[model samples]
Target: MTTDDKLVYMANQIARNFEALGHDHAVAATEDHMLSFWDPRMKARILALAVERADALGPVAAAALERLRAGVVPRPQTGATRFAAVDESGASDAG
Candidate 1:
């Protein structure tokens, strides 16, 4: 799969975990997670794919990507403790 596809699948998987929250909440949480965790380049690539193939993304993932692309959500603060809990891509959070 392409990088965009992998990110889409990963985002969808994240959305699935948040699914029980219901549609709107799930999308919001997913978008927040992406803004807080994903690298800027990854976000940009996904945003582009989101525009080109939004229907291919799951509903929640698509909505989240749209919010990211639109600048509706704020990126996490650099010194925020929330980021301490999240490992960067390909990095381990393992003890």
Candidate 2:
């Protein structure tokens, strides 16, 4: 997938987890995650995607991004990918 699409997918995955906390909390958590883990260039890229193709994002992710764009910059943190690891034959380790 293109990096932009990957960003969207990643954000949606984050949302799926953060959503358990509730919508407002999910938005806050997502914003916190992006601000903390994503570098400026990555943030800018996703922000650009958020503006240019919001519909491409999942519902919670889109909402979270909107909250981020509206102003909620948190400090940066070390990043870790949420994508599942694939085994030799390409099956996700999740299964």
Candidate 3:
């Protein structure tokens, strides 16, 4: 699959999992977060990981994305920011 196709496929798979978990709004919200805040590269990473481990990571990923949207700052992990701007679009200040 092309990169764009892979990303979209992963995003949709994650969304389906979230929806099954009664997190449809969260899915939509997370997608908005990705689109607005994530750079193309970050989006690619998120999607790649989502596709590779969607069965295991989808719920956690959704929760993390929701926390991000809710203005909860992620703590640095091992001296690295848990979440980075996916692209130049940057994170939204409004929560």
- Estimated TM-score per prediction? 0.73, 0.71, 0.38
Per residue, candidate 3 scores C-alpha lDDT tens digits across 1-95 of 77655655555565565464356455554565466566878765765565565564566455655454465653332232334366645345432
Clash-forming residue pairs, model 2: 36-77
Which stretches in model 1 have alpha-carbon errors above 4 Å?
74-95
lDDT of 2 by residue, 59-93 (tens): 88898788778886644322443455554443344
Clashing pairs in 3: 39-86, 39-87
The per-prediction tally of clashing pairs is: 0, 1, 2
Which of the numbered candidates is closest to the native, going by highest TM-score?
1
**Model 3 C-alpha lDDT versus the unseen true structure:** 0.54
Relative to the unseen true structure, what is the C-alpha lDDT of residue 77 in candidate 3, on a scale of 0 to 100? 24
Evaluation by TM-score, superior candidate among 2 and 3: 2
Model 2 segments more than 4 A misplaced: 73-95
